[model samples]
Target: MQENFEDQESVEIQVGSEENLKIFIVNKTLLREASNYCRRRFALELKYEEEPIILNGFEPLIFEIFLQWISNPAPRITYDPDRLPQEPWLSNAATAWLLGKKLQCSDEFDKYALSQFVQNCAFMTFGPWELIEKEATTGSLSRFSDHWVAWNYRLAGPGRNEYSGLRAARATLTAPVRDPRTFDIEHWYSDCGKYMRPRCLHDPITRLEKLEEAKRPKPIPPAEWGRSTELRRERPQ
Candidate 1:
């Protein structure tokens, strides 16, 4: 019997510059499904028999995260205290989001990265608005930045209009607010009145619960007698 393409680890991805180049081995089927960029590249080739693909100007760490996203069953963007400090995590998340766009990664992967970035910003006293503005120069990212600024202004409310950037017009807007020196997740969580947790934080728990509910067979409706009877008749013993 012939081996399945999905099971073959035939793709080698080389990320980053010559000085700090790193190679990643990935399954061709999974890589093709996860990234449109890779799919197109593979299609163009007459015969791609384990040819190593080179990706220039990419952070090796970010690229690794992309690989993990495709390989794992349930991939998540999490902050690791040991590998990275809290402040840099936000920046990394932004980088990951940009990387996803560049690679034309699946919607799920891009959404997760963006959600992490937004949630990370919400937890902090202030965000790396300058960096976000700098990075989001065009396309969907630019629109996202604009929406983020508007959203923050609404959350800040009338009395808490201390942020100068928020007062500016959309076109003139630079950074949403000034950057903070430090961010304490515990402190942010504790102050419920001042800082409400973003929906993204609770999403994982709620999403799983919803998925479990969806998986289980729903009970026949008691209110609709005819429909219930029909359903019961249709069901196999």
Candidate 2:
């Protein structure tokens, strides 16, 4: 949903250089929900009725999406810049993109909030591994490494589709590394790959063949008594 800023509580944020700087008015709630930095700043200003908050060293477009996410009627909806047709796992990419933007803010509280967002969103979406793989591919380098490793500790959590978890892991292992987000992916691959391979289902062709083989009945062997009877009949009395 497009948020109509009119008639809502607004805060002026100073962005860019004085000549290049632009003042943008944003809704207090939108900022608070998306970023802890925005939340705290808004809290102080709301209490004191302070001057416009000055924020420097950030791009307008990134901030625009950051604002848009929280303001969205369907934040649960994955954001794709191209608005490409989504696959079942497309949310993974969207989550990765959102968390990446969160990292750019360079706020400790905001970072924590984004991490929490990922955790909660992953559970709700029933796609933790997709989120994990997405983190490696899209999230910040050092942060995502730690986050990806943390997933092994959360292996095959109940109520999740185990095959989907393994499939996501399969995607992560095979997907090309994007630095610095995935600089360590290769390093982590050997071990995580070992864990995932067995659990991930065989490809459709292999599975179908296996199923057919399993369904085919085995032929019954002839009775063992016939050979024994002939030997006994030939024996001298």
Candidate 3:
């Protein structure tokens, strides 16, 4: 009797930010504290208002990430003094340290294990979608929020090996198309009347001068009939 044979491919897979993942796994609380400190100091720039105003695209899961990030920041990426921004995200190393610290503080589970859970959340919440070409589809924030919240439920542990499975399950979840530039340009032109004036280019403030001049009557031009008499008195013209 001949036996039927089936071939299947098994491949090792990699996912998410390895550096962040490693750091987070190594320590949790230290990362949390550092991130929190950075947020309190630099929070002004990150917010449209004193509190971060949730916009159309802002995800609640991202807010959770934000809370974590504020609690523990990544360390400074750049050491070159001149090139650094006025403020920096906690460095990847610093974050790793913080993550390690967080792991030490919490009894919820192994710090490394929880880091993996948080990492899973981060990956699912912020992962970039592959390029696909198709008809555009629009979605509401509520729909997006609900989807992420569901994903959040799946992060039971690091070794669960669920990322790929979840991704496969949601294979039809398409990335949102950006608004077309042409429409934006048209909208700008429509609003141009609010900001534009038909004034001299060389001196934009010339409009103010023109207004002042208008308030004072211009000296009347000499009459055409008196031109010859005035010219005669000045010179025999």
What does the lDDT read for residue 149 in candidate 2?
A: 35
Poorest 10 consecutive residues by lDDT, candidate 2: 176-185
Superior by lDDT: candidate 2 or candidate 3:
2
Each prediction's TM-score against the native?
0.52, 0.36, 0.16
Flag regions of model 1 displaced more than 4 Å. 1-9, 47-51, 73-89, 122-135, 138-140, 150-237
Pitting candidate 2 against candidate 3, the one with the higher TM-score is 2
lDDT of 3 by residue, 7-108 (tens): 231111111233321111212233334334323433453564432121222222232343354445432221232332221122121132233232232322
Q: How well does candidate 2 score on lDDT at residue 116?
A: 35
Report the alpha-carbon TM-score of model 2 versus the true structure. Answer: 0.36
Winner of 1 and 2 under lDDT = 1
RMSD (Å) of each candidate, 1 decimal: 13.5, 15.0, 22.3
| Clashes (N, CA, C under 3 Å) per candidate | 0, 1, 26
What is the per-residue lDDT of model 1 for residues 33-103, given as tens digits with 9 covering 90 to 100?
Answer: 88899888778765755477877767787877666667773544443333333544454767777887777
Candidate 1 residue-wise lDDT at 165: 62
Q: Any residue pairs clashing in model 1, and if so which?
A: none
Q: Residue 204 in model 1: shift from native, Å?
A: 18
